[model samples]
Every structure is written in C-alpha cells, then in structure tokens.
Target chain A: MNQRLKLFWAGVRAEFPLLIGVFPFGLIYGALALSSGLSATAAQMMSSIVFAGSSQFVTAQLVHGAAPGLVIVLTIAVVNLRHMLYSASVAPYVRNLSMRWKALLSYFLTDEAYAATIIHYEEEELTPASHWFFLGAGLSLWFTWQVSTAFGIFLGTSIPESWPLDFALPLTFIAMVVPVLKDRPVIAAALSAGLVALLAFSLPYKLGLILAALTGIIVGMLLEGKESPKEAL
Target chain B: MNIWLVMLLGGLITFGMRLSFIYLLGRFEVPETMRRALRFVPPAVLSAIVFPEVLMPSGKFDFGLDNHRFLAGIVAVLAAWWTKNTLLTILAGMAALLILQLVL
Candidate 1:
C-alpha cells in the first residue's frame, strides 16, 4: 500500500501492546468512578473529557472523599504537568504539521500514545507521513480507552480485585525505558529519577513526579555536558 | 463548584498543557541545551512514574517481603533488560506478582 497507510499501521502495531495494559486500567477507572458517587454520565464522559488516565483516577478518588471541585481541578492540572515535558519532547517532530493536525494529535497525547509515538519518532528522521504514524497510535488508543471505559461502566462491580492488572502499566514502562538506557547519562537519569520519586512521593498533588522528572533531566544533561568534552578530545 | 465544571476546567487545562510546546516550539526556537535535555525526558519521566507505582503501590512505602509488587518489579526489570520485549516483561511481572501473592 501507500507510505501513509504503512506508517499508520506501524504506529498502530507499536501501540497495540500498550492497549492490552490500558484496557484493564480503564475498566477499573470506570468502575471506581461510578462507585465514587459520580453520575454514570459524568463517569463515562470523564473517559473522554479529562482523558488523562492517572488524573481521572485521582479525580474519582477525590470525588469519593467529597473533595471540593476546585481541589480536583487543581489536582488534575498538577498531575498532568508532566504532559508539558511530553509536549516539548514531541513538539519538534510534529512542528511542520498544520494547526488542525497538531490540535487533533494533542487530544490523543496521553502517556501511552506519547510513549509509542516518541519511540517511533526517535527511530528515524521526520517525513511528510510521520504525523500519520502519530495519528494512528493516538487514535487507536483513544478508541481503546473509550471502549474500555464503557465496558467498565457496564460491568461496574464485577471486576475482580485479585487481578494485578495495574502492574502491567509499570511493566510496560520498564520495557520501554530499559531498552533506551544505553549510556551513563541516560542510566543516571533513570536511576536518579526513580530514587527521587521514592523519596519525594509524599509530596501532594503528584508534584513529586514532576520534581523527580526535572531532577533526572538535569542530572542527565549535566552528565552529558561533562562527558561531551572528553569524547570530543 | 459543580463536577461538570470541574471536568470542563480540568479538560481545558490538560488540553492546554498538551498543546503548549507543540504550538510554541513551532513559532519560537528552542535553545541547544533545552533540546539536548528533551532526550532524557522519556527515561526520566517514565522511571519517575514506574518507581512510585511499583514501590509505593498503596501510597505507603513498602519494601518488605510482603511487598509482592516490589519483588515482581525486580523480576520485570530483569525481563525487560534481558529481552527488551514489552509483552514478555509485563507477563513476567504479572506472573511473579500473582505467584508471590499466592505463596507468600
């Protein structure tokens, strides 16, 4: 077939593995959100409206605790701050696309979509068809998320608590990150970020994640700066 | 402070963050240092998320033998490092957690 279709399918294939992990998580979110006193309509709409998995889960938990709306909204923004880093990481690759394409892809910029798309983008130089791959990955995930949410809403209380489905999310991340840890800076970044996350995890509103990520990025950059001159010499 | 209002505002804020750099970087040039740092974003951010989720599964730090997730996470790490395969790594971790839970 054509290049666009080929690249699109490649993107979908790359994202397929993550969808398996995301589906169960979405199911749990839907069930939890409904049980957390949100109306069924609101719970279902949240899968589309907020669309960020972790934040949606947090919102559900907060709703259960009868948190004020202002607190939930603020929590969402704080939790999703990491998406800014993702936006920066991906911006250069999609810069040449139109505003319309950028807007559409931005809606699909959840963590899983970004994970798959960034890995693909890093493998090659950008081409006219590159955004098509991102669209493919993002779109497939969007579809999976909505469908899984509906299933969760339908079968609200039946999901077994015994399944360790949530563990799949971290395992998927490990699989992604370990393959890319090829150098001292990258390894240091991963280790330092992991350590800092454990240390600062009690920070409210999930700020610890953003702080840990920034610390790791700075660590990686500093190490790279020092190593660059040695390699140049 | 309606729930609908919360969702609307939250959605808009999330959309804005997702759109921020994708829109700005096209218009303005990023510095060389910032560009280099972006390469580390994935490893750093993903590790940050993963470490907390696996280590602090219940919002409290758990490092004892009772923490099956931590043990399973180490298994998954080895699986990911050795195989670099996503599906395999997830399977190994899930299996480890389930088995550990059942036995211990």
Candidate 2:
C-alpha cells in the first residue's frame, strides 16, 4: 500500500477511540435539535453547516428558547473560540500543505479531530504523509457526525422525553478532560474555571463561560509561571 | 436572524477561526503568553461546560442529594480520575444518574 494511505489509516485508527465519545454526542445533538424546534432540514444540515458539537447543542437550546439569530451566531462563535488555539497549535505542522488541503482539513477541525490529530502531529516527527493522517481522522469524524445526526433525528421520535440523555454531553466532556488533569496547573485551571462558571452562571448570553475560561487560563498561566520554567521552554 | 442565516454565519465564523493561524503560516507566531495560555484551553473550557451541566442540571442551581446529575457527576469525576478511561467514566456517571433517578 502507499505510504500516504498507510499514514491516513493510522490517523483514522488513532481517532477511533475518540469517536466512541463523540457518537453519543452526535445522537444527543440530533435529538435535542429537533426538540428545540429546528426543522428536520435545519437539524441535519447543522452537522455540515456549523459542524461543531458543543456549540451546535448550545444553538439548539437557544433556538428552543427563541433566542435571536444574532445572539445564537455570536454565542456559537464564542463557544468555538477555542478552535483558534487548536489552529495555531497545528498551523506549523501543516504549513507546507496546499490551500485545498488546508481548507478541507480546517472544516473538520472539531474538538475530537483536533485532539487526535494534534497528539499525532506532536508525537510523531514530521513525515511527508502526516497531513494524510490528519485527513483520515477529520474525514472519518465528519462522516460519523453526519450519519449519527441523521440517525438521531430519525430516532428522536421514539426516544422517551423523560430520559435525561442530555446529561451525556457533559459526561463526554468529563471523559475528555479528566485524563489530561496531570498536574497542578491543569487541575487549578479546571477547578478555577468550574467555580467561576457556577458563580457567574446567571450571566446573560453565557458570557460567564467565556469569562470563566479566560480567568482559569490566566490563573493556570500565572501559577505555572511562578512554579517552574519547565512549561515555558 | 433566520435559521439558515444563523447556520451560515456560524459556519463561516467557525471556519474562519479554524483557518486563522493556518492561513497566517510563516507570517505570525503565537506569542509566548498566549501559547502558555493555550495549554489551559481544553481543561478550562471543558470544565466551564461540565460544572454548569452538573450544578445546573435543571437550568438552575441546585446543590443537594436530589440533584441527581450533580451527584452522578461526582461519580463520573472520580471514575475519570481513577480509571482514566473515557468509556468507563461515562458509563459510571450515566449509570449513577439513571439509578439515582429511579431510586429517588
């Protein structure tokens, strides 16, 4: 087999584990979007359109509440603001790829894709086919998201309304974040951000979340600065 | 303000952010402060989301045994910390919530 395809397969394999967490999320998003008053068309298209998980869920909830379109758009943007960090981190690795590759990969840069791809990029030295690996991960996820969303939309009708399935979303986040809490700074970042989120929960437009995240980042950075130069270099 | 319009604008902005640094390429380097801060992004952001979901399971704050999600979330946190397995953590947490709701 070709080296590029081999690397692509490797990327897909590496991302397979993360997909376990995402599958339920796509289903939940699909179910919630329909319940949130979105048309079946809008609900399914969002998997391709916004193409984000958490933000899509938030958009559905806001739509259910009759939030203005601009507010939903702005909230989606803020919720996804973290993607810029992922972009900057992976930018150098894929800098040499063509514009077509960059644009296509960028569309699939969801939290799951970024988590898998970034780890692959950082751990494995630059290889000629590394970008293909990224493509494999991103494309596989895109396909799963679309399919799972459609399945959820179809099943939303029979799924009992009493089920607290929405809680699954945060459970996935728990799975994602917990393994990474290896040190003081990361732990502090999580704890501080969580506290602030609760304290500022009443903030309009969910500004509290953005504020809490920023504060936690600053706290983690400052604490890391004081303790060790180990992180900076 | 239409759904399609909202979707389009949201899609464009999301794509823009994902493309921002990649497009800058050789021209811009992420600053040291921002670079350091970025390390905290996942933990900070995820925690910000998780805390509210657990504490505000009903879309409002409730800190008691009756808050099934909050209680189950603690189970998930412990499961995630101990097992460090995504599937296990989610299973443990969800099981706890479902059982709690049934028993309560």
Candidate 1 lDDT, tens digit per residue, B1-104? 89999999999999998999999995776566666777787788779878988888888899888999899999999999998776688789889999999999
lDDT of 2 by residue, A124-194 (tens): 98987889889999988998899889988999878998887777778878887899888898899999999
- In model 2, the runs with Cα more than 4 Å from the true position are A123-125
Residue A69 of model 1 has an lDDT of: 84
Fnat value of model 2: 0.82
Off by over 4 Å in 1: A1-25, A28-40, A54-98, A110-136, A162-176, A202-207, A229-233, B1-6, B56-61, B83-87
Scored against the true structure, residue A85 in model 1 reaches a CA lDDT of 73
Q: Positional deviation of B76 in candidate 2, in angstroms?
A: 1.4
Q: How accurate locally is residue A43 in candidate 2, as Cα lDDT from 0 to 100?
A: 96
True contacts kept of each: 0.81, 0.82
